[model samples]
Each structure stands twice: as structure tokens, then as C-alpha cells.
Target: MRCRASARVDVSEACNLLCVDETQSEHRFEEALLRSLHQGVGRKPRFFAVGAAEESFDERWLLQVLTVAQQGDMASVEFLVRSRVNKTMQRSIRFLIRGAVGRFGGRFTL
Candidate 1:
């Protein structure tokens, strides 16, 4: 079964923050954030990636690559590569190229 990012509210208001230093590392902030959220709560609430649930990263990427190919837009194609899609998408990319080839009957080179 496919898993999704769990739903959660921003816990920033539920407690008092003692530290707000600009020098804090991102990983440190993440650790602190998770700890604070789980602590002092009445129950153990499910936690998710801080931004994963809010971001439509995967769907946006799929649309981007496919749109680029569909329009034969070279810039969007390059943008999709720079978007940091994972290797698993390579199979989908190959499938898309094959489809384009089949659809256009070799008249267009992807």
C-alpha cells in the first residue's frame, strides 16, 4: 500500500519557545521541532515531514516532465531534470518517450 504524509497541525503555538537563534542548524531545528511536538501533549500525535504534506512535489514533477515532452518544450525538459526527480522516474520517462515515438511515428525525436 502507498503511504502518505500524515496530517498534522503546526505545533508552534502549543508551547513556549526558549530558543530562536539564527545559528541553529536545520537538522537541529527539525529534531527540536519533533521533540517539542511530541512532548507535553495529552496523546501521541502522528508526525509527518514538516513540509511533505503541504507540498505537491511528486505530482508537480510528473506534470512538469510530461508537459515539457508534450509541448516539445526544451526549457521545461531541462527544468524537470533540475527538479531532482528520483531514478524511479526514469522508467516512466522511458515509457513516455516510447509513447511519444509511437504516437508521432518517429516524425519527432524526443
Candidate 2:
């Protein structure tokens, strides 16, 4: 089942971020974001590097990565990498790269 952005109002409120109005494009964007994090559908060189290093995929790592990716704040990302999540440099770098890719799309050549 699909979740509405309205349904996540508390989440936005907690994060002090403005809630985007529900629209087809917004829904599509959210879905794409989900797919990229959950299924690795999008091209992310950093994520690829992390995947290469790990024997098994980590959902928690992916979620944290998604959070950083969505926020697009380098200082916050750096803080998250250092303090919050238990990840290697490879994984942290990948998360940073993935966040950048999410914010600014281009040929993620690496």
C-alpha cells in the first residue's frame, strides 16, 4: 500500500521540514526515492562501493543513507557518519555520494 505525504505529517513536523502537498509528481518522487534506497534501482557509485565491501546488505544503513541523501547537508551528513551510524569509511563515503547523486543527478561516473 502506498503512504500519503499527509500521513507522514508528524515526521515532517518532527524534522521541522515543510510537508510537500500531495501530488502525482510528489508521489512519484517519493516512490522513486523508496525504490532507490530499498531496491538500489538508481545508479549510485558510492552505494555500489559499499555493496561491494559488505557481504550482506544492511537495511538500517540504507535508511540512514536515504536520510542523508534527502537532506543534502554535508555537515549533518558528516556528523551522522561520525556519530550516529556504525559504518566504515567505504560505507560513509558511499552514503555521501548517494546523497549528492540524489540531490544533483548526473552521470555518476566513478
Candidate 3:
């Protein structure tokens, strides 16, 4: 899902996304599509934040955090916090962490 700064994505064109699943060799990306809401990868995100002054925001890590949050993976969230992540970005994920804890009943530390 990484994109170069100079690259632009067009929604009208055919999808070129590749998805992988452990249970199957190939998985259709549409399986996770929010058809009713007409929301998917091509759409722009609702929020954007600047990372710590010393470090740039890592979109890949943010995506991973979001995925694990949806799955209620508190351990993974903690592990990511303990990794080489910046303090500001770590703070930014608190809302996601809070939502996961509220739903899954687990504590989070950063």
C-alpha cells in the first residue's frame, strides 16, 4: 500500500492491489470492502498526523496498528509500541488503543 510521493492513484481504473491470506494462496481484496458504505482503499483517509519531530510518520506501521486493532490484538499493539516507533506517533495511536481496550478488555502500555 506504499505509494511514492510523486505517484497518483486513479479510482476509475482497474484495481492493481494484491492481497495475501494464510488460509488461502490468493484472496480477493473485495472480501473486506465496505460495499454498503462505498469505502475502500482508493479513498483518502479521514485523518492525518505528523509524527515526532525527530521521526517521520510511518504509514506502514500505522496500517499494521489499525489492522491489529480491528482484530483486538493488544499484544501486537504493545509490541509495536516497544519497537523503534517514535513517542509522538505512539501517542497518536492512543485512540485506537483505547478503542481496542474498551472492546477487548485489555490494558495497554507505551
Candidate 4:
């Protein structure tokens, strides 16, 4: 299963359906760590470099990474994590992240 935007995994196919928050369903965010554990699946993460484009600051990319992780796309999240993209241009989102986002708040630039 590929997690990138229109990013397709090399696998032949993905399961028809997915279950969430169950013993059967392992969170993709967590799963990505597990996948990273193996020398094969857990290599250095790759992320798309974002320049100072006005439109590139959309939270959609971050949200998409989270959503894809929720859907068990470790590679996608890894790409983001490794790439370290930032979207703090939206001040409101920064406050929200500081207020409540991720296990803990993240880095921000003024």
C-alpha cells in the first residue's frame, strides 16, 4: 500500500478493506515504526522538499501523512518525518499543535 499523494506501492495489491482500533488493526503510524525496524522496510525516510511556495504550506500534506499513517502507510509517514516538512506559516495551526497535537507539540519557527 502506497501512502504518497497518488503514490502507489510496488506491491501487487492492498487488502480490499481495513479495520481500525482493534487487535486486528495496528495503527499505521505505529506500524511504520515496526516496518522501519526491519533493515528492508525501515530504511531512512524520504520526504518531498518544500520550497518557500505560498501554496506549499497547506496543512493537507501533514494531514495526509497522518491519514495515510492511520491507514497503515509507514513509508508515507517516514517520508514526511525524514523530510521534515514544516507548515507553521498558519499561525492558528501552531497554537493548535501546541495546545494539542501529536503525543507532544512539535518545533515551530516564527
Q: 23-104 in candidate 3: lDDT tens per residue?
A: 3211122211111011122233332344533432444554566567556777887786556434544432333333333333
Question: Each candidate's lDDT (Cα)?
Answer: 0.39, 0.38, 0.37, 0.34
Return the clash pairs for model 2, or none: none
- TM-score of decoy 3: 0.32
For candidate 4, give the lDDT of residue 89: 20
Candidate 2 segments exceeding 4 Å error: 1-57, 84-96, 103-110
**Per-residue lDDT for 2-62 in model 2, tens only?**
5222232221122223233332233333333333332232232123333465532443554
- By TM-score, the candidates rank as 3, 1, 2, 4
Residues forming the 10-long window of minimal summed lDDT in candidate 3: 30-39
Better of 2 and 3 by lDDT: 2
Question: How high is each candidate's TM-score?
Answer: 0.31, 0.28, 0.32, 0.27
Candidate 1, 1-110: lDDT as tens digits: 01223333334431223233434333333333334333223234353354565534444554455556556675666556444523434333333332332323332322
Q: Runs in model 1 with CA error above 4 Å?
A: 1-55, 86-110
Model 4: residues with Cα > 4 Å off, grouped in runs = 1-58, 85-110
Which residue window of length 10 is worst by lDDT in model 1?
A: 1-10
* Model 1 whole-model lDDT (C-alpha atoms): 0.39
- Candidate 4 clashing pairs, residues 3+ apart or interchain: 36-42
Better by TM-score, candidate 4 or 3:
3
